[model samples]
Target: MTTYLPKDVTDGLHAARKQDMARKSRLRVEADGRSFAVLRRWQGGFAVDASVVPPLRGLVDLFEGSSPIASCLIIAAEAEDGEMHYEFKRATAMRHSAPLDFQKDDDAPVALIGQ
Candidate 1:
């Protein structure tokens, strides 16, 4: 059985705490062309500290560049650390589906039959 020195134990604890804090580092989250700093990231989705804008209840499309990556709904919001903790889910976009176009193009060339 190996014995760890007191200083070594303290250093190990400090290192573990620092790693945990790093996991909670600020992350950028964009929605509707606006970006917010997220406080923490977990499985499924992340949490944002929205102290500037009032939290709203509805579905929001989160985008990366010009393409949308996630569709999240504002599930819960609470006041914490002088800010609103907005939690969202990485859910699918619930919208009406567009009807399929079945009309053929007039400019299309027809293939020769039995040629």
Candidate 2:
């Protein structure tokens, strides 16, 4: 885990808690959770965090808009194996069918593709 001073930790938590749901970290919103930037927005349904931006922006078309955890590549869930696993809904911009729920699915994705 990353260690920080009491003030730093407190400030970080406060900032994270203030993030928006629109996936725009740079912009402030009234959402209840942290919103990563928009990596890309799909046609049918789905969106993901902008973590893979810059390096992968050219490869995947990260658009604007919010996609649910079920559709975006934001979080990863692991079963009872003590091993890391990604959510079934987790997929690249091209493979999403819906949006992932930000409330229930807050974990980030374990892996990125086409980088």
Each prediction's TM-score versus the true structure:
0.40, 0.19
For candidate 1, write residues 42-83 as lDDT tens digits.
555555545444454566665444455567776665665444
CA lDDT of 23 in candidate 2? 37
Model 1 poorest 10 in a row by lDDT: 18-27
Provide the overall lDDT of each model, using Cα atoms, as 2-decimal numbers. 0.57, 0.35
Model 1 misplacement above 4 A:
1-35, 64-67, 93-115
RMSD of each: 8.6, 19.2
Per-residue alpha-carbon lDDT of candidate 2 for residues 23-49, written as tens digits (9 for 90 to 100):
343221112233335322344322333
Candidate 1's TM-score reads 0.40
